[model samples]
Target chain A: MTVEKISSLQNPRVKQLVKLRDRRPRDEAGVFLIEGFREIRRALEKRVPLRELYYAPEWFLGENEPALIAQAEAAGAQLFELTKSAFAKVAYRERPDGLLAVAPQWKRTLQDLDKIVAGSGGPGRPGSTTPATTSAVGAGAPDLQRAPFILVVEAIEKPGNLGTILRSADAAGCDAVIVCDPVTDIFNPNVVRASTGVLFSVPLVVAESAPVLAWLRAQGVRTIATTPAAEKLYTDADLRGPLAIVMGSEQYGLSEFWLKNCDLPVRIPMAGQADSLNVAMATIITLFEAVRQRAW
Target chain B: MTVEKISSLQNPRVKQLVKLRDRRPRDEAGVFLIEGFREIRRALEKRVPLRELYYAPEWFLGENEPALIAQAEAAGAQLFELTKSAFAKVAYRERPDGLLAVAPQWKRTLQDLDKIVAGSGGPGRPGSTTPATTSAVGAGAPDLQRAPFILVVEAIEKPGNLGTILRSADAAGCDAVIVCDPVTDIFNPNVVRASTGVLFSVPLVVAESAPVLAWLRAQGVRTIATTPAAEKLYTDADLRGPLAIVMGSEQYGLSEFWLKNCDLPVRIPMAGQADSLNVAMATIITLFEAVRQRAW
Candidate 1:
């Protein structure tokens, strides 16, 4: 396939890609920029829809860039060659890897998550005969027997923290991540970079807190809210079962709505003078505790 | 004590305070900026020597600001009142609480730590009658019988990550934090800010890795290095003993020197696509596991 070449810094496409850096344009246009080699690869691997691929030959360092570009092209992505200066204008990092992509924003709602979880053969009950599935069971219409272990985050404000949480969720082999009333854009460039591409690997859904909670209840998933005020220690909570660990923003924890609604409210023991842990750190600790209990 | 008032942003003291925002000035002058009401209070409470306290009357928010200021004054800290504009020029946070301080940078060596640990009535042998001490044994020279559970970090580059680790160390009730061969200053403004003044509340020591490892050996503290490449999982390690959990930077795992010298190498199990976790998050998870095992 012939790659279209664009050298001008003032190119309209470059200007549009630059505009996508801000949240409003990204929201209105329904597209976001994915930069760097790993992120683009992860997006493709996750089957996130790609509209265009831009690469500057001089700055491209990855040995597989040609193969990646070919793969994107085969998947119907329009490929463009960018000049170094032009790429600089559109690139987010100090040292751009000479590759970037404009991908359509994918939205997954609570219903989609419910279907995905239900289709996956939901996590087996403790002491049940059904074998525990360690792999994510989606994309192929999951076998309707596996249980789901979900992470619910309410109003996370920092893109970096959100991304880190996604990485942890991925590492813990969590089924899906539900973002509730996010304060920061899920597709924020920093979030993509911070998650180190785990954002694409993990199944993520965005929805309002009430709807998400209601859906989980319907799905027979227990919701555990983490709050500093909770009397029960996080370790004491039974996390091995089908669980949804709900975490709030660092500045303000779970709203009264969640505190009143969640099945359990637990606190990570804090022996320090500081009242709480960083939200991402707290989420990882909580997620891993479940992982430990499941012996997965 | 009379509170000196300064109104000009051009004031020499204001310029000096602003320069303290950077690491060079902070290191060269042997002092660091402690911002916000809580941080200033924590520093004073920790007995860190304070040279000056700056506050703007117009923006003061904390109800206990007067009491805190009086305490600082009683501790021999010179007090100054700045105009809003002047304070804004020197303040780091967008929503300043109208409080800041210049405190001398405190350094703790392995020897200091050795004395502190030894004085604390170091941890008794397993099955011994000596009860494990839950309190910090410093200030008046701890009874020389308690054992120390420490957290050792090597070459941590980001002030934010380092600060977060310190906060975790405090939360896990680790006796002290030793920053080994650090890339970022322990008293970095961001470290101070990110730690939320836990840097003051937690005893912190900065030393080279060689000396730190040697010191740990001398103190009879088992050194466990965390690396993704390790064969043993962190949970499988015996962490209830007098121990130090050593972690390296994200980009690079523990240096060969550390890896070769550490008593044990362990990895936190990763079950998903992400290779590893953010260093601070990893440290917290590992430390909390120890805390859980110790039942402290």
Candidate 2:
């Protein structure tokens, strides 16, 4: 394993890592930072390619730091020791966890998703094709052929909200999360943290609404758009079948395309003065309803 | 009719408003800042005790500024017209609506809550005790005697999460929200913004967990504690009647007092790698289940 000491804050690599903080630079470089031991471990478990791992021994909090570093090295990550100040400069969190990594950005298009679902002969797996049926199935597994549940988020602006939604989708046993026209980057460090690294565990794809709608239609998956204007209540909808729950930006409801083209549009009944819920909260309520119905 | 113009940022009242940004001064003064036209309007609608109203004519966006100013004056609020720089110094939001207010802090103890609930002969009305049976009954009213749903949040630290939960409780038509041992101030500006002024609409009380739980037990309200470790799924629990959903902080699960003393403990099913959901999202899922069951 190659190990190097990065002592200067002005190092070109450190400058590049700092630039990755913004969306444009991350996109341009096709890489993003993953901080914290748990997040990095999740990424490695999901086989996300790691270009480099930076750690500050003095600031490292976890007991298994050495083992985790060894594991990362085994997984082909070039390890580096960062000075305390240099580590602080690259870390996003207030209390540094003493570990950060630059991982190659991964993307799955609508077409690529088709291959996974069809090729796996079960629910699609985005990051890896191998069936992780043992660890993936928690209480009871969804009948992948008939009850594949998907979550579709559109134009979501907040990284934390998006990450929380991903976490919920994972908890509710969603087959995948389709992010369409997101205002926030999926690989944002905040997203990684807020998701508790569940982003790497869940199957995810990014595509425009038009193609995604068309793809779901082709696959015979019913799209349910959540909007306040819908007449029917969310609980009244049939979500036990192959389904996709589409949510819109917090500021605006679903776009014209989703409102017009989605198979069903339903609203979570709101009885108070506040017009709606936080988008992530709405997604959890909608997804868990499916979980309840499917279990029955 | 009494609107005095204040041109200096260093004015005593202006300085006081600026100091309200932090929790210490807000607590000491027993007052908090309310910004935005919608928030101020909601405060007025709820008859929240407004000590002062400040507005900048140049920055005011809404057409009803004059009418709102008049209404505040009629309601006994001291009105002030602030210079552009003076208003900018005190406003919390970017692109201020040219409206800000100093509202007296409101608190409700466990005993006060009993009076409101029992006095209304139903779910206690906060602002008006006459019981708004007409507008409060959204779709179908909960049989208040049998099915008054309350949300109990314990030791929640984030102002935004607490506020979002307030919004959800309102959306779910929860009778009242009891904040138990809160780490975040219920009247924090972020909470106010996140709730979108639902803070005014929802009847809320703040007290320690032990007393709150004791009060619930005495009132015959079934306290359902949400914990990841609970075996019973939240949906399966009987939530259609006199219910109080107890939630713990995001970092820690419920305190020993709640876990042992609450009537029942339930868990939201998790099928993915994430161990739990965001507290606000969890509250939405749990409360809406009661809403769904009660609808039947």
Candidate 3:
């Protein structure tokens, strides 16, 4: 098969790729654009279907672009070569790496996540809807058995903070990131960029907050919300066993719904006048505190 | 005193405020712009001299703007009222809160910090260069008296990350934040915005790495550097006593100079495909871990 070459800045394909930058077109078409060599490479590695791969050799930062292009082609992605100027016009990043791919958007529901979480434990319990017992693990729990460790964020408005939260969740080895009533599009190019391609590796679910809270109750996952008004400090809280760390939006702490429904509410001790940390930073601190506890 | 009113976007004062968005102009003029009601309020509370205050009544987000303007005026600021269009042209934030101020830049040296740190302890030893004992506090230290908990970052390129780090440092109640060879200007508007006004409260020092390291050594502060290659996990390290957490740039880990010079090199355990967390997130994780250990 011959690769299509487009040199004009006004090429129809370039216009479509540029249009993908906005949420309405991206959502309507049910697809999103992934830019940068690292992002495309991760997408291909995860076997995320690459509908089309666009390249401008002159814009590549390194020698690996050719191999990546070949791999994408072998994976059944249609190949296209754009002139340097054309690629520049379609790129979302300040410094485009000349590799951009259009991939179909995907979604996962709580039901889909239930299977994965249940399967990760010692014995296979695929499709089991049994609520996990609240006493599944005692304080100072043993680390022999794997438990569900999830992060739930509500109405996060900033794309950069959302992406960074995903990165932290990935680093802390979270089972999944559940975004409930998300204020920012998960597919926004900035989110992808800030996540550093971990968006593809991490299991992500987007759903409403009420159902997610209900689903967590059904899964027997203890929801722990971080708030300034909480009595117990995060470090003192028992974060072991099957758990979900719930975080709130940038402008507000956890919503009344999550705070009211969560099994435990904890606060990170703030020593300065700032009163609270950024949502992303707070998530990492809280997530790692749980990680530190579970390491036993 | 009658407050001056200007409606033209082309007014020389408005043009100068717009130019303050860039680093060179901000540094050359020895002043930087602070936008948003919260940031200006924090600046005023901290007694950061306000050279001028600019406001657009039509763009005010709340009824409290008039009180804030009066406070700034009483604090010796020259007030200017602008048309909404003029304020929009000069504002850095996407959603301006109808408040802006130009504050003169200030500097703090290691010598100055030495006085502050020495003063914060239970007893005053102002201007004394006597090195703190290496074993100021044993592992699992008590929280009776404060220790110098400083955050040192080298060559941070993004203004947003730099600002966020400052916010975290402030929340962690750090004694000071020493910036070494910073690539991003600390006064950049994005830094100010991302910091959410924590910039005014946090004691920030801009200096070179070698001297800061030397100052840390002279102060008997243990330097902790986080790297993926470290043999020790951050949680497992002894973080008590006077300490300085040194973070590297976003792209690169700590410089060889810092990595080789630091007392302890530890790593945050990463269990994901992504090798590391964002610098600001990592800094918070490590800082809070220290906060946890010291709380005991």
Candidate 4:
């Protein structure tokens, strides 16, 4: 596990770092980005396929730890020690913790998810341990294709917000995150960073609202629109069945078309002076309600 | 409304902008900072009190909307215009929106909340609305003071997350955000920015675990701790009662003290590979449940 140093930002290997910051390059390569020592460690620990590891020796104090260095070395990850200045040009964060890695997309299909659930012996997801659990794929779930305890985000403008929602989706164990009319790329560098790498952990499908909704309906998923104006409270609406919680941008909530088509309009209750929560915040509440109801 | 432009970062007025960004300065001066045209417009629309407004020509695009300029002038707001480059230095945002405003803090008290509910005749709080209603906040005839909802955020590190929680607190109409122990400053600049200025809107107070539990017990706020381990689903708990939902950081979850003190431990059921949601996202979910339980 020898340390190799790369000073030129234009080096073929260094160019990959620059490209990782750009969404198109990341997508074209079919690989996801992970940065920082902890993120790199998580990737290595997960046994997710590794592509390369870039480091700056002067800064990465963790390099002295043989075990940490050996783990990446064992995986055949390309290691590059960079000058701090050179690292800055390609690092995701201004203060890159001296380790960066790019890993092939963590691939899992709907069928693959089923196999994991069977293997887990509790449920297909974490935090879902109900003995009587409804199957997510082609089960009695409504809108099995269009919505099934899923989340549809329409026209979210901020990458941080979108990624934050993905983090929540991972926690709530929502089926998938459907980005409808995205204003920011789901694979944007910032989104991936903000998601704390949950982007890799979650199954994200991006599509236009029309097709997204159409697919959900085909799958027998009910479209539940969460809004400030609603006939049903979020908790009372039966979330135990096939469901997709639809939320909109912060300034303009679910579009009229989306709202009009909602099987149920649900809202989180509030008592303080707040008029509304941010869209990302709203998504967490609605998605978890689905989680709560199913677990109960 | 005259367009006054001053081009100098060293000017006394420019120094004031720096002070506004600092919480201590704002607190001593009894003010809060708001930047960007959209935020300024919202403040004016709310008829919120204003102290000052500053900007550069780049923000207005030379198309003068009298209303925007007049709102400040009518409010007797002192306006200053700087050279675009100087304005850029003075403004917090990279793409300077040009306009920045300083307004007195509107520290909402219990009495003022009563006035809002009475004037509008809206629901008092969660669990107070009609059973069939889905309006998140209006679900019930709100009970403002004894509003059972409470929030306990444990050891949150990011300023953005804290700010977002405050924003969620306002939207969820939470009683108060009880920071069990926070890792980041509640008043960090990033928190203020991310909250969309809700830092001034919500009742956020920090307290240790014992006092928090004591307050909950005194208020009869049923303490519900959210964790990955909880077998009973969040919805399974009687959410309608006086409730304090406790959620900790993603790393460790609610502290041992909270765990020992909580009346119930609940979880948002999940069906995904990722184990947890961001702290901010989880707070939104917990907050909405209180919203949902109280809605009816």
Candidate 5:
């Protein structure tokens, strides 16, 4: 198959890729970028539809780029080969692996979460209203046979922190991640890089704090909010059952709404001068605590 | 007292500050840069000697800058007030906070760790040979009557990860953090920022791997090396007693030397497609596991 070639940086597609780096363009176009071999590969594995792929062989660090490019093309993505300078113009990472893809933006509302809560564990399993044996399958499969384990964040500032949180949530086997009023959008290129492509594997949704809180309460999911002023230690809190760990922004912690609404408020003990851990670090610590409790 | 003012970016002092950003100039000058109000305040609190202070009022983010400048001056720091444009030239952060400092570099060998080991629990504590309650009544004093807790990192490439690790170590109340064959220098400006002033609070040392291992063995500290192939889960390991959690680099796991020399090998459970957690996240999880175990 002959691939289209674009050697000039002035190419409209290249210019569009650069513009997609910012949120307004990405949002208006209803698509975002997935860069590097690992990120593009993960998107393909998760069956995320790729619209187009741009490649530059001179920038590839390893032999696997050809195979990944082929796979992306086979997945019905248009292929474009660019000069190294052209690729560098659009590549977000310091070191580009010579592969980048454009994927359609996805959205999930609070209403979709009902399917997750009801799908986990077998049918008629205490609090779950939906039958697990129902024809629910694919990405949101109910294979774990346990109560729903969710992670929710409010107004995280850094794209790197948000992405790392997603990666950590996936590592802990979270059911879903619902970002509430994010300062940095999930589709930021840095977010994709920092997430290490876990963005594709994890079920993610973005919504307002009030609606997420209401949905969690309705689903019977116990909410645990992390804050520095909280009297209860995170370690002392009971983390089992249908749980959603609520984390706050880096500078200002969980808003008054979450602290008042969450079922329990907990603090990770701090012995040092710094008042709090990085949001991503705190999320991992809190989520793994739940993972530890659930292991029993 | 009136502070010396430098309005020109071409001034020798301003040029030196910019040069200090890179590793070679920093090493040659025997001083590293510490920027931002919180970081300088933390250094003052820790009694870290400040050789010089630079300030630009136009860039001050908060009202506390005047008080902090006064305090730095009181501590014998050479003060220089710079124009906004001059300060921007020397600033490392994208958003300059208008405060920066130059402090002389200090070094610590494995032998210094002996002081930490002996200083943690009181005199005659098990595994400690030196008398702790002697004239040791200063910063490394025996405040916590428990076994020595340390964190060791090998070839961590990112300044942000190293800084976050230090913060985590401080939060876990570790005795010290020893960087083994560091790929990124401990004094990198980003490390200072990412640590959020924990750098001053925590006892940190940069050394080679071989001697650090030998010293740990001599001090009777049990080392826990984190790797994906390890059979024992991190939580299952008894994190009590004198402990050192050894973390590897971002790209590669522990080097063969560490994997072979460390006392025990353990892994954090991973359910996601990503093979491992970010080094900083993994460090926090393992250290907090130790913290939780010791709490009990």
Candidate 6:
């Protein structure tokens, strides 16, 4: 028998789910969410902690049900159920994916990053005194080579755009993502859903522009700014260098200050009628450009 | 103060608007659509004809109102008034943009492509005998160089992704976009909304894959296929040649048959954990590579 709780839309859990619909809840609770069957399954299978799991009884029932129930029971996840209508209210999309989860935020400190790197089996980071490849670190070695490829989204709006960006970035083997001045919250349910749980895997750093810039500089990283005004095209830029390509918002573009200040300002050339490209596209090209460069 | 003859929600006009919401309407009417304030404004000001426009009288009277009404009227747009709820029903998003319009679908054929090139005073097209050296093509000259760099997409699904790709392609100055096995109509209201009317300006062609592939071959185009399995990096490939970079859907990637049968199979290198870059990003980087190669 399932643990049952019948509650109105005003119930505390439901309210928490509503607040979780946006980014505010994640910041407040130090927890973010994941949704859809595949994503939630990945999180559970990976031994990631789940603070909550909501399923539609009407939609979910199978031989695998007991395992899911036991896993949540084992992890002490707050298990809840809602009728399709009630579940519908909390889900961002009109169709509920039959399962939803709230996973603990992987709050990582700078020292945590350093510790993980030092623990990798490799000699050390490429530039660092210690150098190691990623595979070398798996057996309790600090492999510098396995260090996550960092994706820094300078300024972006539109949850769907951000989600797609993250999903693609994740698929490309990026180590993590740092979103500065994100238009939507990293924890927004839609982002989690759209990213296909890439947000969970990515160590997303949210901060103001200045500190983030400064951090990258301290790391001796190259900052590549994307713009139409630049003379050099993206492919021409040396993307293989430890780089953090900066992308701008939908409207104005990477500010002139960023252009002047960035280590390098590169353009993606236009061959046709429109003056500029979309922010999402710019981010993707910059990312792949780095990939192409690295492969060289 | 508003023309209200198309009063019934079931009116043929309303049905057309709803149908236009889907790509089928775009096909049936042989026209696409645009929504919101600025986009519609530009389209009208550019002498683009409007089949019909829907707006709530009180809503348009609010802020930034006069310019919209005048523009629509001067363009001879058929205007209509709808109850707030009814208008929302016609619009895709829950909230209406205060205005939406249907206009002719843009379909520039391949025959005229040669004509467009002769107009471009600059001989910029790769491998072509003529060069578009200047921006001064006479009335009789074709702007073949209006965009010499062209990208052909095969069976893309998401409208947002297509719109984003167009935006990026526009920034790259891509000549025209030919969608082969298109999943969504290029002129869908959402795609148009996403492209900011760049859709209107960009010469798009919708056709099947086989014919487009044949045409590219006949053009002596170096067709590059982007896939994860390829051994060569995107940068390693010669991008400056007369090329038609064929990129596939984000989900399935370039079809296996497409990859086996096409000219070249190439991959973009990835680091960290991701398998691939987002499609739009991939397109931009791929297109930009050509622009960069040609620039220097």
Q: Pick the candidate with the highest DockQ.
A: 2
Q: In every candidate, how many clashes are there? A: 21, 0, 0, 40, 0, 56
lDDT of 5 by residue, B1-296 (tens): 67899998789998999999899999999889999888898777666778899999999999999999899889889999999999999999889899999987777667756767765433331122342221231135334567889999999999988888888887887888899998998889999888887776566778999989988998889999999989999999999999999999999979999999888999998877655388888999999989999998
lDDT of each: 0.80, 0.81, 0.83, 0.66, 0.84, 0.65
For candidate 4, lDDT tens digit of each residue in A196-259? 7666545566667877766667666788898888867777788877777899887788898798
B1-296, model 6: which lDDT tens digit per residue?
45764457777777777787776657887766667777787565444677677776544535765568667877677777677666666777655666877777655555434443334443332222342221221111224533245678888888977887776666665656778888877777767766766665555678888877776666666688888789987777877656677889978888765787678877766543343356776777777777766565
Rank all candidate structures by their lDDT, best first, as comma-separated numbers. 5, 3, 2, 1, 4, 6
Q: Please, what are the lDDT tens digits per residue for candidate 3 over residues A58-127?
A: 9999999989999999988999999999999999988998999998887767775775456434322221
Off by over 4 Å in 5: A120-139, B120-139
The DockQ assigned to candidate 4 is 0.46
**Deviation from native of the Cα of residue B34 in model 2, angstroms:** 2.1
Instruction: Predict model 1's lDDT versus the native.
Output: 0.80
Prediction RMSDs, each to the true structure: 6.0, 4.8, 7.2, 7.3, 5.0, 6.0
CAPRI rating of model 1: acceptable
Model 4, residue A144: what's the lDDT? 27
TM-score of chain A of each: 0.89, 0.90, 0.90, 0.78, 0.92, 0.81
Can you give the lDDT of residue B144 in candidate 1?
37
TM-score of each: 0.83, 0.86, 0.87, 0.77, 0.90, 0.82
- Comparing 2 with 5 on TM-score, the higher-scoring candidate is 5
User: Considering summed lDDT, which 10 consecutive residues are worst modelled in model 3 chain A?
Assistant: A133-142
Task: Please give the distance, in angstroms, between residue B174's alpha carbon in candidate 4 and its true position after superposition.
Answer: 2.5
Report the candidate with higher lDDT, 3 versus 4.
3
lDDT of 3 by residue, B58-117 (tens): 999789999999999998899999999999998888888788999887766777577545
Quality class of the docking in candidate 3, CAPRI style? acceptable
- Candidate 5: which docking quality band? acceptable
Task: Say which candidate scores most in TM-score.
Answer: 5
TM-score, cand. 5 vs. native? 0.90
